[model samples]
Target: MPYYENAIKKMLPKTYLRQHVAHEIYVALTHFQSLVPMMDKYVYNDGTMKNLMSLTGTIPVMFEDNTYNIPVCLWIEESYPQTAPICYVRPTCEMTVLSGKYISSNGEVMLPYLEEWKNGECDLVSLLQVMVVVFGDFPPVYMHSHPEPEQAPCWLQFHRQAEVLSRTDGSLYLHLASEDDLPFQQENETSC
Candidate 1:
């Protein structure tokens, strides 16, 4: 049997919902075969499969009936090697933006970020290590942030105001000011 058919069979004892999900996965896989390989050495590795199975054991396996509930679906696009597997988080769930940046439910931005990290010569082990480090804790405040002005109205006036703000106890302001430092480091640490 195909992977989707197998998935559907496995999910038959669970709930009708999972069957639908399995079908969808199967359809996506079939339709996008040219885009994604049948097997991924990195994502489908034994370790990775184990991790996914672990997640299935704990996390809510059934898709909740709610506007804010996002269905976690996996898809592979042509960008897999250059990018990351496209993990679709259904838009039903409300995603909170930590600062002010907005990430879509389709995982567009995440793909690029993954690509950059991977293409930067980071090996799969190192990539997984970084992923564990970054995603394990999953700081709530690191999701999204507010967008800043594009032109800043005027550079000179903006800098003057920025300088004044920097002089005072503007930690909150500073924290929201830049996307680079939104995480707010302690004692000038590089790692978040």
Candidate 2:
């Protein structure tokens, strides 16, 4: 076996990183085969993935614990590699960062930052770090009143429901609300 295989096998048995649903899916897709090829094609080619992995490393894993510990579901699709991954966080968990935010199917936040990054406003690494920090304290409710319907650009509307997931327990999950779904309204009500 190659070095990466040995490393992954050892990492799998030792850390909570392997618990991520994405990892399982990746493993299943690879079927014990070398992921370096896929990684080279799908992950490495995408500048965002390189930045993400550089920041979080190969595992790119997170964990949440409460009454019951559960893995956050996150997946990556190549067709939309330019966009962030879709993620889903358990609703029952106390981490509210991702609970109400609209996310893409691949669990990436549809923020203007990505557009700015693409425009050369910043590099991928800085963009990724900024995303991590911004989402780290993300609010449970997204206040849509700020953007006027007529003034909102097509891209904004297109990705309106996309949001990055961040867990208080240091895990992250991405989720996207359906476009047809009614927009979220902010109320004084709080989840108990």
Candidate 3:
């Protein structure tokens, strides 16, 4: 909590235009305990960089009676609530991005909730809930089955949705199952 408070204060200083932004961010973090706030330098495609505040971590997704944690990073703009946060699916080295209707090729999340966000009507918590629901239907990531030949590791196209479930006991387990015969895969990441 102190970490988030300090990061927000340092990264996004108080402003009359963004009076409620800090409080809103604090509330969202409190509700979504899995997400941890941090300040990082964000480099845009144009090569411009800016210090940005991001909530990075995983959110739980339930599938076939099991739960999986999906990694994500949300970058809050200075004018948040007035502007939608830039959201991305931050897949781990063991995971691969599954680009589809909800996720872009570069792992940016493209949801109707984000597209039609309204300042007063939309909130961070609600956006996350929408992500959970939408991702349940269309998962944004899958375990990378093969290791890269050149020393770096990283896709598969199938009708079936993939899931990576984490258990209390540590283990590296993966299940490639279809909807009718759906089994759980193990996620190696921990929640905040």
C-alpha RMSD for every candidate: 18.4, 19.5, 14.9
lDDT (Cα, tens digit) per residue for candidate 1, span 71-161: 2333333333344544433322234422222234333224334556454353223333343233333321222244346524233333432
Candidate of highest TM-score: 3
lDDT (tens digit, per residue) of candidate 3 on 166-191: 54775534445633464543353323
Tens digit of lDDT per residue, candidate 2, span 18-41? 334234334433432212212222
- TM-scores of the candidates are 0.24, 0.26, 0.69
- Predicted model with the maximum lDDT: 3
Candidates sorted by lDDT, best first? 3, 2, 1
Query: What is the C-alpha local distance difference test score of each model?
Result: 0.34, 0.36, 0.77
lDDT value, candidate 2, whole model: 0.36
Q: At residue 87, give the lDDT of candidate 3.
A: 95
